[model samples]
Target: MYPISTPSHAKLLRPSALPLHDRGGGARTVALVSPALGATTFISGITEFDPGTEIPFHSHNCEESVVLFEGDAVMDIDGREYALQPLDTTFIPANVVHRFRNVSHSKPMKILWTYASPQATRTLRDNGEIRAVALEHGKQ
Candidate 1:
């Protein structure tokens, strides 16, 4: 077996999946870190929010936790809005509506997010669409 880390060294995490997000502003994504296979736990690397950027409203089929690192933003979950700042943590349950926006004039917001399942993190990123939003919001 190939050794990963030493007994005293911390384990390393690296992700090998990429998803599409063509919303607003510049959305550059880095897998940052994730293990190849996890038995029952999921981890996040570093997800950044560009200035004046907002992820459209959507929900996951699994539980997710997000911790904000810097800049200003807001998270709307289940018809409730929560202002976000550095070091803030929020939880969003399965199948509950949620969205995030960076309303800051300057500085980018970084969120160290976590999901209960491996595929949950990419659900919103890969599946969200504008045509459906317009239909759901009755703007069409």
Candidate 2:
């Protein structure tokens, strides 16, 4: 079973502390926190998109929510496009095809995302690739 409690003392994770994955063309992702890191039942991460870079269309088996942290983005959900700004929150229902990209050529966009499950499963809509869905503590 996954641990139910956080550390006795506060746990602080800096940007450099997390593993950074390059998504090509300067786009990067960092798994900020997760049940693997003592979180109860959710996984959170930060994704940074360089100007003109975009995440391919994808969907999660579990619900996901994202908070715009900095810069602007054009979010394409299903078939609609929406503009996002700092502090804007977007909630994506499970299995909804969507994608987002930084619209500014001079600035990058950063988003903080949290998933309903500790191990969120993502399926790339175009290629059918799945990611980040490993079971934790043998929990389904």
* Predicted model with the maximum TM-score: 2
Clashing pairs in 1: 14-34
- The CA lDDT of each predicted structure is 0.60, 0.78
Over the full model, what C-alpha lDDT does candidate 2 score relative to the true structure?
0.78
Model 2, residue 92: displacement in angstroms? Answer: 0.8
Candidate 2 residue-wise lDDT, 1-140, digit = tens: 22233457445677666557775666777776666566777777788899888878999888889999999898998688999989999999999999888999999899988888876887988889887643311223
RMSD to native for every prediction? Answer: 8.2, 5.0
> How well does candidate 2 match the true structure in TM-score terms?
0.82
Task: Give per-residue lDDT, candidate 1, residue 52.
Answer: 81
- Residues 34-86 of candidate 1: C-alpha lDDT, one tens digit per residue: 34423235645555777887876777667878888787989987567889878
